[model samples]
Target: MWKSHPKALPYLFLSEMWERFGYYLMIGIFTLYLKDVEAGFAMTEKEASDLYGTFIALVFLTPFIGGLIADRYFGYKKSIVIGGLMMGAGYMLMGIHDKTMLYLAMTLVILGNGFFKPNISTLLGNFYNDDQYKDKKDEGYNIFYMGINVGAFICNFFGAALQILLGWQYAFMAAGIGMFIGVVVFLMGTKHYGDKTEKKGVQEGDMPFYKIVLFILLPSVIFGVIGWLIKGIQSDTNLDSYIFGSDSTDAFIFACIPVIFFYGSLYFKAKSEDKRPIGALLAIFAVVILFWAVFKLNGSALNTWADRYTDREITGTTQTVFNSLKLAKEIEYKKDSTELYDAGFRLQKENGAVKKVVDYPIYFRNVKEDKKPEEGSKISIWATNLSQSINPGWVIILTPLVVAFFTFLRSRKKEPSTPTKIAFGLLISALSVLVMVAAVQIGNNGTEKVSVWWLVANYGVITIGELFLSPMGLSVVSKLSPKNITSLMMGGWFLSTSIGNKMSGVLASLWDTYDNKANFFWVNFALLMFATLLMFALLKQLNKVMKEKGIN
Candidate 1:
């Protein structure tokens, strides 16, 4: 890979791989840690999902500012180093096991990701601007994306082992250690970047940093405050009590108003030659929000599905392997225990105090009577977080094939435009939801556990869609962005992702609301289909802009 590409490619790939390892590891067990009645915060599903959504949304949202700062003031390398250290520190702090510390750690990770994410991507894109590498940009991003999944794919196993062997704190600590290693790897490769890490500096008509803070950042904070304070219509179960679904959701949406306006202004105020590209990029950004909204469910709603609906039991060879690897734990059957759990722990009020009783694990609730172990017998089951690796595993397996398939088309002069790939990607992703709907039906609406293959099959289909859309999205932004605002444009791509991530959270929080789980998945399917239609409708215009820019 390095022979034909920039010497920096391997280093960047490894750095990104490690960074994602830390990130995905933390995320894999985040909600599970939150909802663990014995060792965690004991939050209900809604509370944990709401917080998970907000955490990830903010993580992506910061790139807008981080990218701008890097474009004008801090260079990419400096920003990345600063961000990496913050994230590493944050991950370590999470092991403190205090709510205050957890929030503080989350803040650090969120802000760190903002600075780290877009700048590294922009730095990689910069290398591809040369004529020799220009046509290879998409391929480079795909390889880089594979690196991301490599980290994502392997981290869950380590997480499972650590959490099972030591505790959640140890797993979290491992994430921090991984981040520190990534920073070290990144630093070692600084020499290869040369001048590519330099800042663009402020250009003519560019908003001054102070002015941006005054106009955009300040207003967003105020708008968020208003959204938090002002409640919406009252309803039973607190439905619609706050705008959107929760205070954080409402606040986040409101906060994005000024930022969204800022992006819009970019197109309107652009030089004539730049307007069409910016407009095209923005349109692509908007349509892909639905994709992220669904894809991000891997960490929230899908995690819940793996934990509750999927049959994770192992026996004989499989059980032996998992046990030897420390990836599975033994849960003893205790049929007479008074402890009960539905979505969360069952609580009883006694003398004005609530008590949580320990009983059988929730995993056996849907197991067939015949399949249940005899009393006092133990059954081995793999960690639920291990399911988080399925999508990335597919990405690792299929990326080269997808790249080769597209390359074959390129050889024939018949490869789809980036936008076309993205449109088809949305459609393909929509079909993946149908697999989940089928899973729900097959599992008999959670009355029985479904085969783990349902999750596997679902991830396999979506991974292909992801390959088509995600790397292509990154490549298109690099191809179409005006030279002065490349990082900013990359940030714009993440902005759509941030919004979609929050929306995923909002959707996941409502997991209990659907009596028929298939209906929930159907809603997801509809969102993606609508986005696909919208993208197809605008395809001609988008393609025209790409052609005008002299890019495929």
Candidate 2:
């Protein structure tokens, strides 16, 4: 793959792979670790999911500012190094196990991601700007994306092993170590980043940075404070009257209003020639929000599913292999007793008062009589967070095939434009949710432990949609954006991702509200379907712009 691409491709790819390995490894177990009563914060599902949503949202959102700063001030290489170190420190600090330290650590990771994520991606696209490699931009990004998932695919095993053997702290430390290694790799290959780090001086129509800080960031902070202070003012329940879904949810949504308006103003005030392309970007960005909203559930609602509902029981060859490999987590069963209940998900009292009751594992209600453990017997099962690997595993397996398929399409003049690919992606992702709908029915709405195969099947289908949409979003932004604002537009893509990520949290926090369970998946399906319809509606206009820009 690097044969025709820049020589830097392999090193950048490997650096990113290691970075994502650390990041995903930490994220794979984030919620599970947060909810662990003995070795964790023992937060409720709503609390943990809400926080998870906000964390990832901010993690993506800051790239807007980070990209701008790198474009004008710090070079990409310097920004990336700084971001990596900050993230490494954050991951290591999270192992301290204090709530205050946790929040501080999350802040560091969020800011670090802002600086690191967009700049690295921008640098890759810069490499492809040359005439010789221009046509292969999409393929390059696909390859880079595969690197990310390659790391994502393997990290969970390391996370699972360390968490099981040493503890959550050690697992987190491994994440920090992985991040540091990525930084070292980037430094070793600094020579290759030369032309890609050009500073884009302020363009004619750009807003001043001070104005942005005063009018945008300051208002966001004030709005966030208000959102937090008034959480329970309207409803007796602490959650019901909140602005979005939770206090953090409300704050994040409110804080984004000014920034969202800023992106809109760019199009509204653009010169006539720049208008069509910016409009196309904004429209596509809107639709893809649904995609990220669903995909990000891997860290929230889906993690809950893996932890509570999936049948993790391994037997015969499978059991023996996992056990010998030291990848399984052993949980002792005391029937007619409730250790698992307390260690599992729970609901809050309507008044936000602490409820002593431990929520039942949605899985236990339906275990086959034969499979249910003897009242006093202990059961050793695979860890729930280990299920997080499925999608990345699919990515690692399917990337080459998908790339080949697109290559074939390109050769035949049959490949869709990026916008069209995203439309189809949204529609396909809707179908993936339907798989979960089926799983819910088959599992009797978590009355019994569903086969791990159900989770595997769901991820497999979604991975196809992801291949169609996710990397294409990056390629689209790089292709259509004004040269000076390329990184800024890339930030816009991540902003949409930020919004969708927060929405995923909002959706995940409501897991208990949908007693039927299938209704939850159905809601996700409808959201994506709506996004698909919107995309198809604008396809002609978007395609016209793509043709005008000579990007397709």
Candidate 3:
């Protein structure tokens, strides 16, 4: 894969692979860990998804600060290493099983990711600044993207096996180890990016650090707190008392307002030549919010679909094969065990604060009485986290095919522009949700378990969309961003991702509200189609801007 590409590509690729190995490993099992009841946090689906959304949103949000800091102070290499260590330690600490410790762990990962995520890609983008690599920028991002999914694909297996053979704690510790390895890999290749990762001092047109702190960061904190505390109109439920579904969602959305304003300010503040490109990037960013909202459901809403509604039972020859491969494990259907865990539902949050929710697994509720296993009998079922691997699995399988297809188009001089790819990507992804609607119909709305192939096929279809949108988004930012503000604009891209991720959480938190599961997916379909239409609406103006910028 490194043939004829930048030498830095492999080092960055390997470093990113390990980094994603750690991040995705933890995330793959995060909700399962939260809802474990016996050994973990014992959160309800709503509680877990709310936190999950916030965590990922912040995980992406910090890149704004991280990118800014790297651009002006710490070099990308230093920031990347610092970020990696913090994240590794956080992952290790997650195993301690105390609420305060968990919060501390999460804080470390959040801060670490801020330092790590955007700069590494920015560093890669820097490599392509040279004339020799300029035309290959999108291809490089696609290759880099494949590295991310490779780690994402492999880590789930490790997470699953460790959680099975040892425990969640050990599994988390392995994530730390993966991160450490990533740091080591990056260090070994410092010579490649060390020179390219130059820090840019604050420029005349740029927002100063103090102003950013006052206007964007501090205000975000205050706004978040206000969003958390303010009592507003309610629908006879505390969850709906605040805006945007939950307190965290409210906080996250309100917090983003200032930051969103900051990005919009960049356009108004940009040099004349830079204004159109920034405008184009912001427009695309606005539309992709709907894309990430649906695509990121893999961990929450879709995970639930896999867990409760998907038929995961293994028996006879299939059971023998799964047992041999350790792909599935025997789960003893002990009603007493479920009741015992349910009793401890009011356990401490990560801050040692008490948590309360409706205490029930809801896992057994949908099983047909006659089909239910005899009490205390063990039956083999595929791992819940295994479902998390489906999307990345598709990424690994389909990336080369997508790349080849596009390469063929490039050779024919008929390749869709980056904006065009992204537009189609949104359309294709919208269609993936209909697959779940079909799954819901097939499962009789969770009364029966549907085939695992429904999830697999859905991921397959959407993976093509991912290949189109995600890497292309990175390429667009790298191409369109003004040289001095590249990291900040990259931060803007992640800011959009943060909001969308938070939105995904809000959507997932509503999973129980709809009596018909198909209705939930229909809402997803509608959101994506809306995004698709909006993207097309802006396509002409966006292409004209790209042409003016000489990006293609």
- Cα lDDT listed for each candidate: 0.90, 0.84, 0.86
Question: How does residue 115 of candidate 3 score in lDDT?
Answer: 91
lDDT of 2 by residue, 84-170 (tens): 999999999998899999999999999999888888888887898899999987778778888898889888888888888999999
Query: What's each prediction's TM-score?
Result: 0.94, 0.92, 0.90
Q: Stretches of candidate 2 above 4 Å error? A: 1-4, 131-136, 194-206, 230-233, 236-240, 337-366
Clashing residue pairs for model 1 = none
Candidate 3 lands at a TM-score of: 0.90
Residue 336 of candidate 2: its Cα lDDT? 36
Of the candidates shown, which would achieve the greatest TM-score relative to the real structure? 1
For 1-552, candidate 3 gives per-residue lDDT tens digits of 577788899999999999999999999888888988778987888889999999999998898899889988998888999999999999999988999999899999999999988888888888988999998987898788888989999998888888888899999999999999999999888777658877876866676789879988998898888888876687766646776777888878878878888889989988899989999999999999998999888898888888788778889998897777676778655454223333323233446554543443345555666777998787788778888888888888888888899989999999999999999999999999989999889888888888899999999999889889987898899789988777678878898898899889988999989999899999999999999999999999999988887766
Q: Which of 1 and 2 is the better model by TM-score?
A: 1
When sorted by lDDT, best at the front, the candidate numbers are: 1, 3, 2
lDDT tens digits, residue span 1-552, model 1: 678888889888998999999999999999999988777888777888999999999998898888888878999999999998999999998878799999999999999998898888889989999899998877788788888999999999999999999999999999999998998999899889999999988888565789878877899999999988889988896776987888998899999998899889999989999999999999999999999999999999999999988898899999999999999999887663444555444455568776765433788888888888998899999999999999999988998899899889999999999999999999999999999999999989998999999999999999899988987888799799998777578778988999999988988999989999999999999999999999999999999999998888
TM-score rank order: 1, 2, 3
Q: Give residue 293's error in model 2 in angstroms.
A: 1.1
